[model samples]
Target: MKDWNEKCAVVGIYNAYNASILSYYSLFSMQHRGQEASGISSSNGEKISTYKNSGLVTKVFDENTLKKLQGNSSIGHNRYSTAGEDSIDDCQPIFAKYSLGELAIVHNGNLTNAKKVRKNLIEDGAIFQSHLDTENLIHLIAKSHKHQLVDRITDAINQIEGAYALIFLSRTKMFAVRDKYGLRPLSLGKITNPDGSVGYIVASETCAFDLIGAEYVRDVEPGEMLVFEGAYSKHITMPKSIKIFAANPKPCIFEYVYFARPDSKVFGRNVYEIRKKMGIELAKEHKIKADMVIPVPDSGVAAAIGYSRESGIPFELGIIRNHYVGRTFIEPTQSARELKVKLKLNPIAEIIEGKEIIIIDDSIVRGTTSKQIIKILRQAGAKKIHLFISSPPTISPCYYGVDTPDKSQLICANHSIEEVRDFIGADSLAFLSLQGLKNSIQNAGEEKFCQACFDENYIEDLQE
Candidate 1:
């Protein structure tokens, strides 16, 4: 992606009291997914209430706001800029009131045909209040002739071209749907309360399941719609007859390598284990004589551990990251991003002053951040810094939910491996092979996840 930020998480809860608290907890667990904004929409049998703002979850909501959102069924969202610029109006759980009642929707992933859809909707007299793709979905569903909400949703989804894992809140029932290719991760789980009532949760990742004391039931099947009716649940899988643009199912490979939390499982694969194996394979590709292996903080920690274990090199926390930095993309300018990264990360001079270090990271998007990081290590008196990427170079842009820039925007696409190494000022640099990446996720089931960003083998026609 052209230095674009990642999108947020969509969470929905059903048949539970203190739904606002559950929303708070779910959004908090997914804070890493998006830090730009947080929102919640709840229904208390009679009316729907919503509160959303452009800020971190902690800063956006308080006890009074939670108390005000009294409802038994609710949906929450954490946002990173995707279709819209970073503004409070773009914060989600976007609600639209129409003749058929009110609907609130939270979405994760991007809609490839959103611009076209928006123009069509506008021509048909539908006014837009925000730049989110979810609003387009709401309008599509509202305009569909189908009466059943699931049928209308299916109809609307057939027109959308990219990835989406959505949670829709109607007057009574809550619905969750995943894209046909299953590009984004969504799962269903349930929690049992002591008051003889049950609660159902839908989140972007399984880690959210653990936080809410919910047991994961199953992943939302591709091209499936799930409806929870407070006491009963129903599922509908779109018929295979539906003509979907079939590109190779290139789920964002970055999710396995970096974006997902280590503890979470994506597409039946454990992220931590997959990342560790990537490191092992990376070590095999480029053997380096390093005194110690150091990860570039949080995202690289799992791979660094794996590299150390495989190469028999000691692992050290040579760099520390400040957790307080908000989303880097939200900064108004490039200079701000540079300054934030410097402030957020500092090298340990004592640990790397005279050491030959191997720095492991997930991927290098634009190479700007990596360059600065390497500069920091060099200034810290490191003898040598060899950089290893856990995944293959991202040459093509992502057309799925991920907000990747045009192919020309990818630094690696414009520069050779040696050029990138020189630009980053690393002694040596290597990326995990495509085969190595697939091998790393051996436990992730025989069917491949999406590797289109690295390998231009898409299962579906993206240009359509």
Candidate 2:
């Protein structure tokens, strides 16, 4: 299924003997976040070394590449370009040299005011090397008058607007900071070294901790900065008014809806469990008679199962996804995209022949994919097709990190529910209510979720 891709995933490790290797594994686990590029930077006491390329993490970093990035502290990034052209320079863990020393930075989330910041910096004669907003942040840090790297980062952050979960590395220290609103997520983990010493890790999601045998400690609070000096981690506070609008965090609700992996615990809740709850809620909202409930595989599996259990409809593997299918949205032309959709999923004729099927999906972005799937099911002789979405209608484009289509391109943003159902050729289409979506996820306090894509109640002032 084609869905909005998350902008990136970040991992930072300190005081570990084979920091680069661990980072490699961490990025490997979160490869779904960004498939276009992967990178890692390691600090070996006196200088920082980096290796990055456009490809999957396993394809980009082999044993030889990891060996070259030797250090006891490292930072890594997996990127799907949201703001910049996909190029060598845009692949992250972007390094820069300033008067202080060598510094490298990796970030997740978009800086909504980066265009303004870039214009101002250009007027001040700052030379930017890449088109990425990440590079804009680097320029900000490099120009700060503060002598200490942490202080410089804090100063730079105060000047920027919008969501960020950033990790910055100097030769001796590693720092992790979250945007004041916490529109994106970053987690802290603790692991034991081979020598039994403790090491610290920070990643976009807790699933990264599980793969590396680290125990999750807690989420890095919104507006908080964590400094890792050798084996110790400390909280650092900066100037007032750094917070723009939100007094507390408002993490992107879409993380639970689609972006995050089911295995991940994002924004303090298990994604799989939350997705299942959403499915249960969807089932309650829209009662339907169907022989079986099927998911648009991989992302929609959990929700489909929950719907099946709650509605007394057995779940079956009606539509199977081709594991090796390339991302269809990235295909260049209309014909290529249409062909890609057919190649990516196929319905089981035997199971679908006479059965009334209910297809459960996270959200409908453009409705093209949904239309294709319904057509395929009908061709396979499905008597009826009903589509149920786990989240409210996505009406606005997400400005934080997710690479969403423009509001004009979004089907729900323009068409009513009935119009969308007819457009996709489904007998019925139902979406979970906003209240049901909030109640489905555990600990998703009303104030903590950024539902801008659904309700357009953006936390940040988009006006310049």
Candidate 3:
């Protein structure tokens, strides 16, 4: 709860050879998006088959389970439980049997109007099966009087409000759509089959495409739906695009700051380049003199490099993270929480001994982690510790699928910058300004983004 939790990952494969295997690889590449559970649904122009469980993709499915999928089209999900309770029923792709044949869906965002919609459905004598708002789609689609599945989907989406990058799988077709606000990312790709045919892949990140030997095609436009029909063997064409709503894109800005992989090209900009720019911007804003610059590891490496280059400070990988650390079921005691931090990230005493160091980090939520980090650095003989945050303070919680702590739990929300610095035991602390963040991206043109966590500007009414 202290760390900024993650959103889910959704992927769809249309007409690909061994579609379920490709879906498994795509989900594997995007494991950072979610790690709680993974599942895949496949259709071979007959009955739909789905297999999923509460574990990582590797543990959830093996060769035997994937062999049973038997389909040329597939949809997959990796969940971090932004909306529903952590249960077997909540794992996706949520399979259902309705009047319109068999259908399965994978979703990647939160529904802000879930309460009101669920209330109306229950009053209308609809029995629910799961805690997921995604299940609401199944109910709404099943209840629709519309004759065609496409029309029914439009009707169902019209009734919901919030962030969603959705992929719906049917017996012979696949559909991908993003909410009008586009608060989550979804990209399109093309895969060349061994038989000289072309298949299409859609995923939450471009890195998924790379892993499965798929080439990036573009992002799925906001407020648009792509309907994939016909087999890929003969007539391989683009998915039919339906403009469900007038374009009003407001993609999530935090994708660049934290969630997305550095190698990804989100919203057509390289994530690593944008992150480096954020670091350069932070360095320009704060001209603190330090003996050396150190990154918090992994997430902070790019930004620390930018800062080091800008400030002429030597950059060192002062912290090393344990890649093998897995979550422990029994939560550590409050007094012993620092041990958990130590287990994950440890300082290099040789690099920090008697040195005035600047530590670069992406963002601070509860301040506990940063405090523990600073404590370890001091014990390593750091003379002065200056903490530099790459992004602006997270002052609000995210309702657009990201799992963030409430405002009351956000240390930066209630405390002044200096007060936070004192609490973290850092000699100096500074965060990137909103203007500086905007200046980091190049030629962002005519595009709007959702930075609600930093600005408290909720795009859609949370109560809606």
What's the CA RMSD for each of the models? 3.5, 3.0, 1.3
Best by TM-score: 3
Query: What shift in Å separates residue 265 of candidate 3 from its native position after superposition?
Result: 1.2
Q: Candidate 1's residue-wise lDDT over 236-332, tens digit each?
A: 2221222233433345667887778899977777889888999999988878898999998888889899999999999999999987765556556
Best by lDDT: 3
| Model 3 score (lDDT) | 0.91
Model 2, residue pairs in steric clash: none
Q: What's the TM-score of each model vs. the native?
A: 0.92, 0.95, 0.98
* Per-model lDDT: 0.82, 0.87, 0.91
Model 2 spans > 4 angstroms off: 231-247, 327-335, 462-464
Winner on lDDT (1 vs 3): 3
TM-score for candidate 2, please give it: 0.95
Q: Higher lDDT: candidate 1 or 2?
A: 2
**How many clashes in each structure?**
11, 0, 0
Query: For model 3, how does the per-residue alpha-carbon lDDT over 1-464 read when each residue is reduced to its tens digit?
Result: 13876699999999999999999999999999999999999999988899999999999999999999988999999999888798998899988899989999999999999888899999998998889999889999999999999999999999998889999999988999999877889999999999888899999999999999999989999999999988734676889999998878788888988899999888778999998998999999999888999988788988899999999999999999988778865567865688788888999999999999999999999999999999999999999999999999989998889898878999999999999999999999999998888888878765578888899888855433
